[model samples]
Target: MATIAFASSSSGLLFNKSKETSPRNGASLFHYNGLKPVEAKQFEAKGFISTSVRCKTVKAAVSAPKRETDPKKRVVITGMGLVSVFGSDIDTFYDKLLDGVSGITPIDRFDASEYSVRFAGQIRDFSSTGYIDGKNDRRLDDCWRYCLVAGKRALDDASLTKPVLDTMDKTRVGVLVGSGMGGITAFSSGVEALVQKGYKKITPFFIPYSITNMGSALLAIDTGLMGPNYSISTACATANYCFFSAANHIRRGDADIMVAGGTEAAVTPTGVGGFIACRALSQRNTDPQKASRPWDKNRDGFVIGEGAGVLVMECLEHALKRGANIIAEYLGGAVTCDAHHMTDPRADGLGVSSCISKSLEDAGVSPEEVNYINAHATSTLAGDLAEVNAIKKVFKDTSEIKMNGTKSMTGHGLGAAGGLEAIATIKAINTGWLHPTLNQNDLEGDVTIDTVPNVKKRHQVNVAISNSFGFGGHNSVVVFAPYNL
Candidate 1:
């Protein structure tokens, strides 16, 4: 049933009209009215407006949330692919995360002794030997290389090989991979050539390879997917935005399948130097592994990471017809802008809180249903607390909701962060084990909620929300749950 909601200033309340439902524990899940204007004033001192609904009780049993019955509108993740610091395989990457193995290491690709930050979660010895042709493999930027390999790997995971793909309708498939710093290496090299040598020294492939949409375009061209193809460049939130948009395309009947996610290879000299100039990188060169401590009071800044994560998203009917293995279901997602700062998050965190609320409403789930959160905790002082504060506004009792930070082990992957984290969320659903947020010594006072610190915990996640907030106050949240037949 379609949900309908109404709000009036005179009434000072918003109420939802939907079917009443009960959880596995036989406790009634009430659709409470939205927060009143008086409740909104709670955030006045923090510099933004916010509203929230109160939950009645906390349930312990894990049960799947309401899913769309219509096959065409229902979106499922058939495959997940990633080129992480650990490796290119999904199981290996997730296993490392669950084991609390830190991937951050000293910058060895270039001379970085003079820089403030000398370490990152850089992918060492990445190769596209079998994926791309010899000539194009060497010529393409790492950003392009990462996405191409990840996207193709995702198709393989979906069981859509060359012979299988040939039988499917090519026009009904699409690609929507994104990158925040698109072709930074190529752009930097082209400019260096123009400055040091001359205009004649510039490479002819500079413009074509340096644009943001080239990754998506090339993936489509290589796979022969002729439907909706484009890229979103919303910094850290790029992957979730792509997933959200790609799922909607399937829901709207524009496409039957999509290769969607984000990629970023910004571990180059220019990328590291730019973050250093902005003072956004941690200089804990002595302890690079423990540098990305999200809720730790000793954290100075975020550790840079680079890689790609892609997912093969398909409609339910399409998957059933082909006898595909479904990984998880894409419930709903929402994006919002803080409209407050370029690099800094809003002190009040109303933007993020609102985005989470909207995502839950769209998913036809309540705050009580979400027992896990893959938070966008980047180990920065203000960012970690701001995200936690925002989360408190939506979830008053986090005692039931366990939140963790993926950046603690992998560092911040910028555009690729959301895609990597989403894979972690789905893994948690399938494995019933939540990875620990490492290096939680001297925890922040305001962060009282359980972060599952230092060790993995066995917990059945009913509904999980993965958040990715970026520069320019772009906030995004995507909901995921186990796929049940």
Candidate 2:
């Protein structure tokens, strides 16, 4: 019942003014602690009004209708969490985004003299120790930490604590989260301790804590989820793949509860130097804050970023039976390969278009119904143009689609890109606002649709998609629809 402030948008809900927020207005329907029901309704005939000791107020009702096809297993988002330079919630993040405030700064995670681009959009104030219990922190890596905090926050937000699978039937519960580059930081540190110091100094838990899949595995361990555990690697599309696979799992009824999302912590010398070697990073070192200017005329390349995004996906009957909050619906997803190049997309965007078409089919929605699109506009010349062309192909009529990218604000998060963008899409649905492409000074190349630029625009978004195409010709698209039932 503590006083808290919250702002809602089609994009997402944000509690920016305060870090720890009171339960939202609608949580009262479930655990408001403000009301109690009487077993006997016969007294109602005597005009005796039922008393509710709880003071919580009902602000609004959430109505998500179940699908007639299969009622028990509709995919619904119960909770979401985000960690970026933009702030935890979507609005705080979008505010920093619209102002063109880049989180990129001088490399502070580690020394980077040899790396051409040392600056990155790193979460300087973040600490994994806080995400994990202090006692268990030593056994976890940066990747696991990011996922842990975000995942914990999501479960809490959903009003569902980590399940005690041992005490309950957990075969229906699962977890899946990916990292574009996981444990690279831990790997770098372990090698230093092993070679420079001594093999004895190396921790015994190096490998499990450092692998990409351990983040999700640790989530399962911490929360006691025993359904499924897996990690996916797709360079930058890692999170999208996680979301895609999670949606499919729900569709197949493989799991009723799937903790899904992605985390990335690859801003070390290995992460920065390797990308620089590929000539894929921006070199606006003089102006680090403005370096990540996506869809801009002067865009050099992408700015490295590190963070995580997490979402709690549950089947409709499960959420309804527990009276959990429903944030959004995961329509479905699609994945494809370019088969053209390892690090470059096809010039004509043939593969990208196919990915979009496939995702639309998976979601059972048409391109015409898609109102907003979170593009993989990393500010690169070929990548930007190619994706736009692909959008044109799949959308058929680009004039109606509202498109933009969050990278201009948070920088390219490599593997975390898809996960963070998915959070952005959910925020858009919550707030009904779409961010303008910051630093896009000019409408260059071929932009057919309405690319919101310079300022944030508010509009209704019933169905939206987020695109993440990573290196090795990996392309992923996820579609989310506002729950109608």
Candidate 3:
């Protein structure tokens, strides 16, 4: 009744080595059946110890196949919401993008005239009338306010009212709203209070509102969702990462519905000064509207923006059961790291290319199937062309894929960029139109892809991918397709 087992020693396999070896070098091990040293050798010589166990284990470990899941449990976007510079309305946001309107304007919230970069895609006169209460609104950061507004709106868009949500299991709903720099204004103000007045001057709500996870926590509290609630921060790639992670939660049956996206409010003095120090802002002070020119030769740097974008995602089965308004299908997505540079992308474009390939593989789509790409070109000289190189590597012909830089008009929303661009991608698929990349008069290099420059174009989009990369070498790509029964 001895057990047969396999043990490893410092020298080699237990059966192959001498049993009398010192403990430092190796130890005499027994099989699961407690075979003696003599019996183990007899079994080993008969190929029981080698081919029957060791070789098979090594082979399985080296060449295991990836498990494929049923595509029927796929996730789909039931609704989309955003608090962009354009407005809280999704139609208004998409319409403004179609007209090639630049949201970049002078930073008038505070005196930024002396700063090198003074313009941003700032949202003015934002009101959370019905979304949040007045007392909490005044106490919370703009980041928290945006999340509360957008998350509730997204649920509304999905037709998931309070009554309907109460009928369903609250534990099956989750929230995963992320941010790159959470509550910058609150953090800066807290620090100033600690320096000038005292720690006592700081508000008690500072810690609760300043953390990155507060956005998701607030959304969950407001909606009473008791499921998985968390935040992901990967700089600019935050939104796409959230979408990818949230979709998997649904696919894995952990949750039936997920409110996922990214929010940011980094338009304060410290936010601008930090980017200015890194020389990552455009100094086109004369014309703030044209400051964010993505592929143009005169492009300097990205114009920082602030906003939140949220998507109400549910499994196809769950959506159909709930009779949700289906918008688009979340085919698949992938995330990768460059591991090359801290602030800049890898010059070789390997990270981006691999990400795109893996995304397509996950979506079970081909390169030719993707007719459009919402490019992550943030108007930077190096980043703009580097993404194009990676796209070219993925789609060799380039003629079939019409890529556009939405950041040209929206500027760089940082953590919320992917969420906003994801909405743009889904909108483009729903409506048969593609927005232009503003201010592309003089192309930067041998750029052959038609950027849909200067004006919107009417095109039928079948499958599309939205690309978003971050400062810390994080690259993410999400694939979307028209939802069809």
Candidate 4:
């Protein structure tokens, strides 16, 4: 399904590459027969216009006044986007996962000769030029740039546009894109710039660009969204927390539509040094490709990955009214903490289990109903087994559980894992295939859970649970079910 918009009002005109026709400098009215969907709003004047496009297989943007709707009605994921060391979309990412690809590569962005862990799962090939114009690109921090591009990709993947904003109230739109440790690149660059040419050499946008919220703020402003805007910074568990917050907003009727995800581009000096200082990163400098071996007996530490993942979430009523494409419904989610430590989870995995259990309970679904689980297995010794213990304790008929760790390919996407894993789960359900937990040749430690390995396998899965446990004992679980009317 392909649809484009070109509206010219009595003033100025803008257009998207997808536009089919050029209208004179006058306001053009767009009328969508099904769910008004547009890519971009290029017009001379600003006024809400209702135009709809119904994606036969997938739903479009928001629509007419939402009539009667169920509060507990399942929430479907209409759109998804990701930017990792792996290729951008589900297809590329899944292929690498099934093939046991490792994102760890030597630190090329900066000379890592002095660091203990020189290899990280850095995004090496992205030009960023295609997504951001050269002039504005310099103004954005690395993390924000990643978020900006990822967010736009998600909207495009969902076949949504700025013109579709007319169907839904702009005030009801929100953005929550958490960056676990945002603008580290900016801080590094700014310091270098300062030392090279004094304080005057630094750009004014440094502060705004470096903060995590700038990415989310810019996203909302760009799309004219203004509902429940905020950012979460729970380290590795950032995206899970953002999605959980966004879901709560929708359920509470704070906003009808929201964009939730996380981004991280912390492949800089401070980032590498900080993690190394904590002894939390992998030191497989010679064999970077085989560094992140989850569930493997010889795994050492996590391979730091850099990327972003964004999901567009709409209120049940709003989505139903628009007949929006429902990819997978987010049944429910929850967040918890161990309160036991600042950096490590309790060996007993009590908080993680409580979060998983409560999330299933909140969604009102049985653990047996969950077919596939996206585990928070970072290949780190203690953390990996702890998450597995948590999952084993939460579900029923646990032996039949099919679990995969997407981080195997994307590297540990840090905060972005929550939403990136969502992309994998949705694709898994939509395509009826389970991506493997890359680099897992042998199971290790006291964990005895099944690990999907080596390639893509087709399986009929209904519900998928994605887990993310961040630093500070933060734990979050998101439940996604097959989109059913």
TM-score of 2: 0.82
Ranking of all predicted structures according to lDDT, beginning with the best and ending with the worst = 1, 3, 2, 4
**Candidate 2 per-residue C-alpha lDDT over 380-439 given as tens digits, one digit per residue, 9 for 90 to 100:** 645676676677766554555788988877887777778788888987887777877777
Q: Per-residue lDDT for 6-92 in model 1, tens only?
A: 111111111233422333555323333332222221211122222332222334325434557898988999988888999898889
Q: With candidate 2 superimposed using the best TM-score fit, by how many Å does residue 69's alpha carbon deviate from the native?
A: 3.9
Q: What is the lDDT of candidate 3?
A: 0.80
**Model 2 lDDT at residue 199:** 88
**TM-score, one value per model:** 0.87, 0.82, 0.85, 0.82
How well does candidate 3 score on lDDT at residue 278?
Answer: 50
Q: Ten consecutive residues with minimal summed lDDT in candidate 4? A: 5-14
What local lDDT does model 4 show for residue 375?
84
For candidate 3, the TM-score is 0.85
Between candidates 2 and 4, the one scoring higher on lDDT is: 2
lDDT of 3 by residue, 1-485 (tens): 01111111100011112333335555432321111121110001111111222211221122222323354468999988899999999999999999999898999999998997789999898989999998998889999898889889999999988999999999999999999999888888898988999999998877888899999999998889998899999988899999999988988899999999999999889998887755567778889899888778887777889899999989888888777789999889999997855554554567777888888878866665677899888877567776777777777556656789888888788889889999999999999899999999899765788899999998788789999888567889999988887
Summed backbone clashes in each candidate are 0, 19, 7, 17
Error of 4 at 476 (Å): 0.5
Candidate 3 regions exceeding 4 Å error are 1-72
Model 4: how far residue 399 lies from native, Å:
1.3
Residues 206-241, model 4: lDDT tens digits:
787778788789888777787889899987788988
